[model samples]
Target: MRVALCQIEVGDDPKENLQRMIDALRGAPEADLAVFPEASMVRFGNRLADVAEPLDGPFVTALRKAAREHHTAVIAGVFEPAGDRVHNTVVGIEATGEISGSYRKIHLFDAFSDRESEDVAPGAEPVVLDLAGTHIGVITCYDVRFPELARALVDRGAEILAVPAAWAQGVFKEEHWTTLVRARAIENTTWVIAVDKAPDRSRPPRGAPGGVGRSQLIDPMGTVVADLGPFPAVRVAELDLGVTERVRSILPSLTHRRPELF
Candidate 1:
C-alpha cells in the first residue's frame, strides 16, 4: 500500500499548524493511508492546559473531515485531555469518517528537565488497528526507544509500526533516529514508518539537544526506502506487505527464539 508521511514545521499557533496539515494533505497524492507527526496540530511548548483538547475536539474532527474528503485513512497526534490531566495521544480516522482507534503515548518524554510527566499522563496500552488489509501499530516519540512495546505489538499481529515523534535537535540525533528506527524494524520484522517534525523557529525549540527533521520509512528487512530530511515536506512510499512474510520465512527468528531463559 502507498503511505504518505506529512512532515510539517509546527508553529506556536494551533490554528495555523492545523491548517498547514490540511494543506499538506491536499497536496499529497491519493494513498491508502497518511500519517502525521506528534503534536502536528499544535506546538509542544505551550502550557498543557492551554493546548489540551478532548479526543473528539476540533483538531480530530478536522482530521476526520480531511480523511473523508481524501478518501484515505489518517493517523495524527494530538494532546488528549482526560479529566484533570492530559496524554500524548494518536487518533486514527478512517476514510468513511469513522473514528477508528487511538493510542496514547506510553513512554512519556521525561528526560527533559522541563518535567513532561508533570503535565501529561502516560498511557499503559499499545494500540493496533486495521489499515486497508494490514494490521498497524501506533506509537509516539519516546516510545520508539522501548523495544518491548514494539515487540508486544508485533506479537499481536502488527505488520507495520507507525511512530509519531518530536525528536529534538541535538548531537548525533540524526544517526540515533535512523539507527533506532531501523533497529525497531529489524527486530520486529515489520515495516516501520516514522513521521517526525521539522524545527520550528517560531517557537522556542525543544530544550533537549537533538535535530528535528528525520522522517523515514523502513521495510521489513530494515532497508530505508525513503528518507524525508529535516525540513517541511511530504514523502510517499509504497510498502509491499508480501515482503513481510518473505523476510520472516527466511529469518524464522520469531518461532526459533527460546524465550524462557531470556
Candidate 2:
C-alpha cells in the first residue's frame, strides 16, 4: 500500500486545521492511505474539555468527507469526550467515508514536565483497523514509549503500526523518539507509519517548543524508508507487506516466545 505521511502545522481553529489536512491529502501522491499528525482536528495543548467532541461531531464528519473526496483511507489523532476528562483518540475513516474505528491513547503524557492525566483519561484497549489489505494498529504519541502495547497489536494480526503524535521537544527527546520508533518496528517485524505535527509556537510547554515534527516511516528491519524533517511537509512511500512476512519468518520472535517463563 502507498501511504502519505503529513507533517503539518496546526493552530487553534478546528476548521482551518481540517482544511490543512485535506489540502495535504489532495496534493499527496496517489496513495491508498493518508496519515496525519496527532491532534489533527484541533491544536494540541488546548483545554480538552472545551474542544472535545463526539464521534459524530463536526471534526470527524469533516474527516469522513475528506476521505471520500480523496478516495483514500485517513487516520489521525482526535479528542473525544469521555466523562469528566477527554480521551486522546485516533480515528480511522475508510475510503468510502465510513468510520472504521477509534483508538484511545492508552498511555497519557504524564511524564517529563507535562501532566496529560489531568485532562485526559487513559484507554484500556488497543484498536486495529483493517484497511488497504492490511491490519493497521493505532496508538497515540506518548504510547510509543511502551513496547508491550505494540506487541499486543501484533498479536492481534497487525501488519503495520500507525502512530499519530505531537511529540514534545526537550533534552534528548528527539533521540528518544527516533530510537523507540525503530525499536518497535524491529521487534515486532512490522512496518511503522508515524506522523507528527509541526512545532506549535503559540502553545509552548515549560518555556520550550511544543513538539518535534520529524514524521517518518520505518520498515520491518528498522530501516527508515522516508523521513520528513522538523517542518511542515508531506511524504509518500509504497510499502510492500511481503517484506514483513519475510522478516518475521527469519526472526520468528513471536513464535519463539516462552510465555510460561515470563
Candidate 3:
C-alpha cells in the first residue's frame, strides 16, 4: 500500500486550513492513503467550540470531494461539537468519497501543565477502517503515549495504525514522539504511519505550543520507512504489506500473548 505523510503546518483559520489540506492532496503523489496531523481543522490555542462542526459539516464535506478527486483515502483530524466541549476527532474518508470511520481521542492531552480536557471531551471507543483490504486503526496525539490503546486496536484485527499528532515542542518532546511511535509499531507488529503538523513558522520559536514535524512511517520490525523532516511537505512511499507477515512469522509475539495472566 502506498501512503502519503502530509506534514503541513496547521493554522487557526478552518477555511485556510481546509484549503491547505486540499492543496496538499492535489499535489501529493499517487497513493492509496494520505494521513494528516491532529487538529488539522484548526490549530490549538484558539477557541475550538466556535469553529467545531459535525462529521457531515462543510469541512468534511469538502474533504469528501477532495478525496474523491484525488483518488486517495484520507485520515485527517477535525473538531466536532459535543455539547459544552468539542471532541477531537479523526475522520476517515475512502477513495470512493464515503465516510469510512471516525475516532475521537480518548486520551486528552492534560500533561505538561496544559489541560486539554478543559476544552475537549474524551472518546469512548477505538475505530478501525478498511482501505483496499487493509485494516487501519486510528489514534490521536496523546493516545500514542498509551500502549494499551494500541493493543486494543490490534486485538480488533488492525494491521496498520494511523497516528495523527500535533505534538508540541518542549524539552525532550521530540525524543518522546519518535520513541513512542516506533515502540507502538515494534510491540504491536503492525505498520505505523505517524504524521505530525509541521512547525508553525509564524509563532516565535519559544512563544506557544505547536508541532515539531518529524512525521514518519515505521514497519512492523520498527524500521523507519520514510521520515519527513520538520518542514511543510508531503512525501509518499509504497509499503510492502508482506513485511508484516514475515516479521510476525519470526517474532509471533501477538500470538504468544498470555492474556489470561494479565
Candidate 4:
C-alpha cells in the first residue's frame, strides 16, 4: 500500500494547521492511508487543556470530510477534551466518513521537568484498526519509547505501526527517535511509519529550533525505505506487507523467543 507522511510546521492557529494538512493531502495521489503528526489540529507543548477539543468538534468533522472526499483512510492527532480532563489522542477516519477508532496517548511526555501528566489523562488501551486490508496500530508521540505498547499491538495482529509525534528539540533526540523507530519495526517484524512535526520559532521557549523533521518509513528488517529530512514537505512510499512474512520466515525470531525466561 502507498502511504503519505505529512511533515509540516504547526503554529498557534488550529485552523491554519488543519487547512495545511488538507492542502498537503491534495498533492498526493490516492493513497491507501495518510498519517499526520501529533496534535495536527493545534500546536504542541502549549498545555493540553488550552487546545483540547471534543470528539465531535469541528476539527474531527473536517478530518472526516477530508477522508471521505479523498477516499483515503486518515490517522491524525488532536487534543481531546472529555468533561474536565484532556488527553492527547489520535483519531482514525475511514474513507466512508466513518469514525473507526481513537487512541489516547498512554505514555505522557514528562521528561526535562515538563509534567504532561498534570493536564492529560493517560490512555488505558492500545488501539489497532484495520485499514485497506492491513491491520494498523496507532500510537502518539512519546508512546514510541515504550516497547511494551508496541509489542502488545503486534501481538494483537498489527502488521503496521503508525506513530505521530511532536518531538521536542534537545540533546540527541533526533538520533534516538530514528533508532527507536527502526528498532520497533525490526523487533516486531512490522512496517513502521513515523510522522513528526517541524520546529517553529513562533511558539515559545518550549518550542526549540530543531526537530530535524526526519519523518521515515521503515521496513520489517529495520531498513529505512524512505525519509523526509529536516524540512516541510510530503513524503510518499509504497510498502508491501508481504515483506513481513519473508523476513519472519527466514529468521523466525518471534516464534523462537523464550518469553518464559525473560
Number of the top-ranking candidate, with lDDT as the measure? 3
Candidate 4 residues 193-217, lDDT tens each? 9999876655454434434588999
Clashing pairs in 1: 168-210, 169-210, 169-211, 170-209, 170-210, 170-211
**Count of clashes, each model:** 6, 0, 0, 0
After superposition, the stretches of candidate 3 with alpha carbons farther than 4 Å from their true spots are 204-207
TM-scores of all predicted structures:
0.94, 0.96, 0.97, 0.95
Higher-lDDT candidate among 1 and 3? 3
Q: Flag the better candidate by lDDT, 3 or 4.
A: 3
RMSD of 4: 1.6
Stretches off by above 4 angstroms in model 4 are: 205-210
Taken over the whole model, the C-alpha lDDT of each candidate is: 0.82, 0.86, 0.91, 0.84
| Model 1, position 99: C-alpha lDDT score | 83
Model 4 steric clash pairs: none
lDDT (Cα, tens digit) per residue for candidate 3, span 1-262: 8898999888878899999999999888488899999999999888889999999999999999999999989999999999989999999999988998899999998889878899999999988888656899998999999999999999998989999999988899999999999999999999999999998777632236689899999999999999998889899988888999999999999999998998
- Candidate 1, overall lDDT? 0.82
Please say which candidate is ahead in TM-score: 2 or 3: 3
lDDT order, best first, reads 3, 2, 4, 1
When summed lDDT is taken over every stretch of 10 residues in candidate 3, the lowest stretch is 200-209
- Best model per TM-score: 3
